[model samples]
Target: MSTALPSAVLGAAAHQARITLVRKYTSAAGVSTVVVSLAVLVLLWFVRDVQLGAAQVGAGGYIFSGFLAFGVIAAAVLGVAGELQAEREDGTLLRAKAVPHGMTGHLVAKLLAAPVDALVPVLPALVGAALLLPDSMPQDVASWVLLVLVFGLGVLTMLPWGAVLGSVFRTMIGLAWAMMSMYALAALSGVFYPVGGWPAPLQWVAQLSPLYWIGVAVRSVLLPEGAAAAEIGGEFRLELALVVLLAWAVAGLFIAPVLLRRMARRQSGSAVQAARERVLAKGY
Candidate 1:
């Protein structure tokens, strides 16, 4: 009554499952990315020529910097955390643990998958903004490189923490708190406006979060030199931005593995079934 599949076949199937999981999440996240990117671009289109700030900053360019930060947050935090929670609840995580090297492949795929899925929403907003308002975006090779560097680092900085969120919060209600935390960061991070304009205490609070520095790095690439007047020190502070973001990346690297391993170890069929029951109890 028991016929085990061949080892080679099992390995192949495992690999296929890994790819399928990546594809599944990527497809699901893509539509949202495209829609949000389009919506932002449309917003950019209307205000392509409008200006703000002491430097007479273009609204399109300002939003581009902030939107870049938001796009990364959506993909890296919300998208990745939610999928991990779903997998755990739906028994995919338990099944992955049962297969040899399956959890390894799953983690690797997920680590890479978030950014790939992130590009779905982020790249379009960036590229669209560039194409429509070339004057407002980075025009030189150097600025563009810095732009890419900061954007890449920001995602890398946040993703491990996102995993931590997924691992710690078994329920969707708890996960929703993570999204709210991001919004709270956005409110204080000066993404939508200058942080210095806030109360002195609030300015200090904004600096405590990584999103503020991310916005600064982005503004450096896209905003005019004169725009620095709006900053607390009237400068870009690129070095500080890099240091904070790098610190986050390093911290995450250390934290994600331990948390993920613990989470994987704890996952089981009964736990997943219970999670599903909780979902049903809430009426979906």
Candidate 2:
């Protein structure tokens, strides 16, 4: 009975979250996201011939792989951070705080919704890639399997830390700065180019970010063996990539709940109103 009751509560919470997500994605704002994704894909397609490395490998495969990881990171980090900040300002978090186990349910909803958030933007890009750059698509079962595995792991590793980011930055302006830093990391992490060409200290910094490892994992499955010549070590370090991503996932598991609980405990109606006033005052 104890287990069943908890399951039922969680299930109900998840259902509510699903409904909210559906409503969000079905709206005009959701259409804008799809359009933006398609626009980015078109831009990438135009640069498909910009080759990289001594192998002179086509950029299409690398772009597709890197963009795939970018989408996951966007949904897990940017999406979650933005949503939490908005919800907090609008009193949603306060309402959630009023209910029993509400914060847990809220977190569950965000985590579950994140993958879907990623897919919405990614699907259009994927279709565009397949149709426009047919050669970039995974041709074999093993490659496809690896793509899915890396993508799932990417989502798991990033979501909790994303929640932490969202919780830490209480204001929208603060969140925007955080997101810009993440974008800078993405650029340095070889999302669109080779990181091997970067300076030693910068290269080491890029490697510390999971974004770089996610790119490595995605590229391992998408690009040909010869393409590894452009990578940092001139080879696909799949084992190290897996270890790095796993370590981030494990760390996030331990860190996220504690931080989220702390964030929730601090939420109040007055705090929400004060945040709203700040936003109004700053015109952000």
Top candidate (lDDT): 2
Full-model lDDT for every candidate? 0.79, 0.84
In model 2, the runs with Cα more than 4 Å from the true position are: 1-5, 44-51
**Every model's TM-score:** 0.88, 0.93
Residue range 1-284, candidate 2, lDDT tens digits: 35343886679777977897889888999878888667768876797777766777677777777778899899998988889888988999899889888777888888778888888887888888877776667898887887888888899999988888988998888999999999998988876566876788988988889999988888887777888877797897988998899999999989988988899999998898898888788876
> Candidate 1 clashing pairs?
none
* Lowest summed lDDT window (length 10), candidate 1: 2-11
Best by TM-score: 2
Cα lDDT for residue 229, model 2?
Answer: 79
Model 1 vs. true fold: TM: 0.88
Error of 2 at 278 (Å): 2.4
